[model samples]
Target: MSEGFEKCHNEYTLFTKTSKEGKILIVNLYVDDLIFTDNDEFMFLEFKNSMVRELDMNDMGRMRYFLGVEVLQRYDGIYISKIKYALEIL
Candidate 1:
């Protein structure tokens, strides 16, 4: 959980590079988790693989960082909230 924090802002960063081009993103990360938004599936997996190759990371499939929040990703959009943290504190 967030423990004693009153407010939380998630952050994260991802870089995308193809054989021809490159891109970058900056998101939020607080505590040991994060939530990011993107739907470029093919490029997304490619970037994830690139990250795996660069760092000795244990690939835990997907759902990398839930941050004590709920992540609902769909064809429409994504849903995220710190409901768990709120409940814990209450």
Candidate 2:
């Protein structure tokens, strides 16, 4: 992943990328699931395509839930929660 992103002009940070255009892209890899997000849609698609070319990955569309966290996208902004996880613990 690091090498692939570097080829796309992205700075690596353990698990994040700051594009040359100053857009932030984050990727969290679990056992077999991967979740990612970016500020720019065009840049995001570009990166996604690059990943697809370099690696065998399946695009899961928009992220609705990841690692027990529920993701909510609204007109105003994005909201994330661990309500399901919390309930399980309680």
Model 2, 6-64: lDDT tens per residue? 32335333366677778877666667666677788886787789889988998877778
Cα RMSD (Å) between model 2 and the true structure?
Answer: 4.7
- Sliding window of 10 residues with minimal summed lDDT for model 1: 2-11
Clashing pairs in 1: 10-28, 10-29, 11-27, 11-28, 11-29, 12-27, 12-28
Ten consecutive residues with minimal summed lDDT in candidate 2? 5-14
**Steric clash pairs (candidate 2):** none
lDDT (Cα, tens digit) per residue for candidate 1, span 1-90: 211112323312332222334333222344443323334565556545665687664545545237477666666766787877798899
Q: Which stretches of candidate 1 lie above 4 Å from their native place?
A: 1-37, 64-66
lDDT of 2: 0.73
Each candidate structure's TM-score, on Cα atoms with residue i matched to residue i, is: 0.50, 0.64
Best-fitting candidate, measured by TM-score?
2
Model 1, position 53, has a per-residue lDDT of 82
lDDT of each: 0.46, 0.73
